[model samples]
Target: MAQDEVEVLVVGAGQAGLAMSEHLGARGVPHLVLERDRIAERWRTGRWDSLVTNGPAWHDRFPGLEFADVDPDGFASREQVADYFAAYAEKIDAPIRCGVDVQRVQKNVGRPGFRVETSDGTIDARYVVAATGPFQKPAIPPVVPGNAKVVQLHSSSYGNPEQLPEGAVLVVGAGSSGVQIADELQRSGRQVYLSVGPHDRPPRRYRGRDFCWWLGVLNKWDEAAPPRGAEHVTIAVTGARGGHTVDFRALAADGITLVGMTSWFEDGRLHFASDLPVNIANGDATYLRMLDEADDYVARNGLDLPEEPEARVFGPDPECVVDPLRELDLATAGVTSIVWATGFVSDYGWLQVDAFDADGKPRHTRGVSSEPGIYFLGLPWQSRRGSSFIWGVWHDAAYVAEHIAIQRSYLAYDRAIRSSGPHLTADTSRHNQDDEPTVTTTGGSAVQVERAAGAQLGER
Candidate 1:
């Protein structure tokens, strides 16, 4: 087995990992980025063909990099997003090793670093940055009967309407992906059934501005993560049809059947809970809440912004609210395809450390893990509502880089004073023999760490 060593190892070459690599490079940090496939592989292979970005081009991009030839309000396609990241990787000259599958990562035995096992070889890293992004494994629930005869596909594998067989398509899960796929299928002349779920309703544009801009100025993007075990909300907005707010009433009127949460599948019949009305109500509540926040923000500053009264229709749809479908006979309805757009889950089985909570949530202060020498980046709500967004990832990577730099500087200083361990290249001018070392985080700002005085090498 080949053995290598590095100061830092970043796992995943998606937006998150590339951002980490770029920041580390800018700091002159000795690091290497490992990816199981090519850069931005998930965007190229894991997403549907017809999918577009959730945010518009201007707001959903890395800082200082514009999506050229794309309208600022327009949404980039899946291909465009993948290419954009690839181009960013190139522009930053990121040091990446692709096609390397990381098998496991554990503390180095009797050492001060981690042993990262990969298909290529073992790479000993002083610190490991798990920048795999939010999506790891497709979370598809088992709702199909054992004997059902339907072409089932998770949203990760779903391509376009033409790929499915000639029959009705039932899209379960009303998150952005599911809703967008259902809308696409229905517009392609296929009978579509959308299983609505509890989701946050966000308009594509609100008050002559993109919804992201409103969220940014309103500080919604800076919203902190909820307490552990608290329920979270999934955004149900879409960027399809250039960019538009999702109106369930309009979708119902457009001939797509709106169903409730799927309960069970038995006797070739799919049963649904009567929570359709409640879900619609909850979504409407969020919609109204967003509008009210925006309106108040505008009024508070006396800022001039147009009000689209047409966007404020809060009435429930008759088909979905009054007479929601409870049960559907798959055979009778001629439904042949099922697209499960359920959410994704992180697979940390390869990570052998105590950096996670009982619920498998990463235990981190921002991106800095409780366990030293370990960090996480690009997790949804890891630090804020925008942690997983492209620009958010860049900022998060910078924070993590600062943490790593400060830690490395302290270690180097201690080693130079004590004359122990291998030589490190980290600058240690901040850790002279004068002040005590301590670290604290000021939310949404640059990292703040006290100078080190007598801290030993390898002290976290």
Candidate 2:
């Protein structure tokens, strides 16, 4: 068996792993990035054909590399995002071993580091960074009967309306993906029914600025997590239609039937929760809360941002919300295909270390796992709400890289601290102070990864 050794091993070469690789490389940390398939495979192939980023190109970017020809306010198509990551990888000269599947990672019994088993070989790495990202597996519920006679697929596998059987399409889960797919199907002359569950409806643009700008100026992305009980509530926004406010009622008016959450399928019919009205009210409440917060923020800071009156006003509820569809005979409704825009669950079953909870969630604080010499990245609310995105991941990766550099410089395991000057500090906030996500080094050249980031507006 072929085997090799590196000081550090990075698993997965998605946005997270690539960001980690560049930071570690800049810090002179001997690390190898291993990818099971291809770099940014999730973005390149795991999404729908018409999918666009939920954030504007300006804010949804890595540090230092402004998109060459994209509109700053326009959202990037999935292909463009993949290309950007590819370009960034080429520019940084990331040390990635593509097609190498990491099988298991475990702590060495007699050694102080970890034993990583991969398809290529096993490696003895002093540190391991699991940057496989949060969306490891599709979280499709088993509510649909195993023997149901209909074409059904997870949103990750969905390509377009033409990919489905020629009949009414039932799109479940009214999250970002759900609503977008539902609207698209309806426009394509397909009778579409959307199963809307609890969600947070934020405007695509508010107060003469893109919501991304508002999030930055108001520090909303810096929020640690959502309010209690709404932790998993999907943020309903879209970059589809050149980026517009996500309104269920507008979709309803467009002939897409809005239904309640799918409850069960039995007794020769599909049952739905009678909570459509409640769901609508909850989403509206959140929507209003966000608008009010923005208003207060502008007034508090004396900013001259224009007011959006239409935001404060609301029209009548949709007919489905007023009188929710509680049950439906699939044949009578003419539903022939189902698109499960359900969520995802992180897969860490291969991790032999006990760095995770009983529920399989990695136990970490700001990417630093509870177990020594282990770290996890690209998790939601890892350090902040923005951690899962590129810019956020860049900062988080820097912090993790800084931690690794600090450990190497100060600990210098089995040896004395070899003449230390100014050590590296994991200052995540210091980087956030800049408009474009720029690295701010607080130590020697070991972590001097800063590049004067570009903020030039784009036009795609």
Candidate 3:
């Protein structure tokens, strides 16, 4: 088959890739987006029915598109948000190849392009954008034994309480998904137990202002100016990440018993840290204090107030108690369901590229990866204030797109030099940082095979 060529190739058609494709198309850059499934397929399939965006609708939009007729304080349901993304792709007429699973992507070492092999065909492009979301993989805890009869499902697989067997349910992980799922299960009349961890629990609203409003007012979302490595940096947690703040107090008010962090699971029962509530409460206090300081800083900085700052507290019941190292035996406790709302992991094994660091994260400055003509968007904390959020990817996308354009211009200069004659030597330094062979691949055979394949393609 003849090789398909494009100026840019995007490896995912989700929010980030779609946004990049939209921007690239608007700029008249030739690009093609490849998605393994239909656009927004994860959101449509992976989320539970009760799933609603934790952040408000206004904060959930991508660039050049807005969630229409939605209340700023109201969260968009999973279906609604998915539809919005579908509409976004339609609006832009993005050149997306849906259902095309990319098997591998490797640099054309001897050439100025990349070789992308997919289920449909092979694509060679001048640039590749890894817009596959950060949460492409779910992180399942290892504490649960494989032999247990208890039904284990990640928050991504949970759709509703009805999916659980008859009996009480123990929802593990005190993050937003765990708490929210626990609340949903309890409201469905299932006796629910939440394994609380060190987490922040702010109200959905503060002083009649949306929590998001305050987040913006205090620059909590302004991750750009934050002290590097600060854990308090706000992340955009819409869609699968759920909202940053879950109504834990409200869940407790509805009679869901909060327990300590899960230590381990044996015989289908979950063990918890006896002092779980204390840890949760302490973390809650720290968050409140941070918010208070943020409020004060905003006021001191002469920032206009959205509303009068109100005294806010964290956690549901200040007096809630938890036993240290207590075991909640699911068989004895009659809890039949275990929902792991733990978190996500980024698994990029499919992108057979040598640009990642030891931690498996793509080595990049801004969105520019160590590999030339390769970029990443929608990374956690990629930019200031919710840069990984659907809305936030726009800034990174625009910046990266502009950078790509500049690199394209430089490539033109290099091409002109090459076309002029053998008198000019290639300035190898112009290649990006990945050109430096810092570390060899873990699999020498795989690297050699890739190099051999690249060599064969170059010979073509």
lDDT of each: 0.84, 0.84, 0.71
Residues 1-460 of candidate 1: C-alpha lDDT, one tens digit per residue:
3999999999999999998998888777889999999999999989888788989998889985799767988999888998998889989998899999999999987889999999999999999999997789887788895458898888999988989999999999888988899999999999999999888888888889888998899988898975343355567889988888888888888878999999899889999999988888888888888888999999999988987887876655675568888999998999999999888888888889989999898999988999899999999877788886888888889989988877776665455556744443332446555534343211112223343454432243
Per-residue alpha-carbon lDDT of candidate 2 for residues 114-173, written as tens digits (9 for 90 to 100): 888989888889999999888889988888776788788999999998899888989999
lDDT (Cα, tens digit) per residue for candidate 3, span 1-460: 2469988999888888988987777666788999999898878998888788777887668756678856765688888888988999999998888889888888897888899888988889899999987778888889987678677889999998878899988887776677667777887899888877766555455445556666676666776644544354222123333344454555676778777878876666677777666655665665576567656766787766564344453443523453333787778878777888877888888777778999998898877899887888888778776775677787778888876765554444345455764322333444453342111111111111123323211121
Residue-level error in angstroms, candidate 1, position 241: 1.3
Worst 10 residues of 2 by lDDT: 451-460
How are the candidates ranked when ordered by TM-score, highest leading?
1, 2, 3
Q: Where does candidate 2 stray beyond 4 Å?
A: 417-460
Tell me the RMSD of model 1 versus the true structure: 4.5
Model 1: CA > 4 A from native:
226-230, 314-316, 420-460
Evaluation by TM-score, superior candidate among 2 and 3? 2
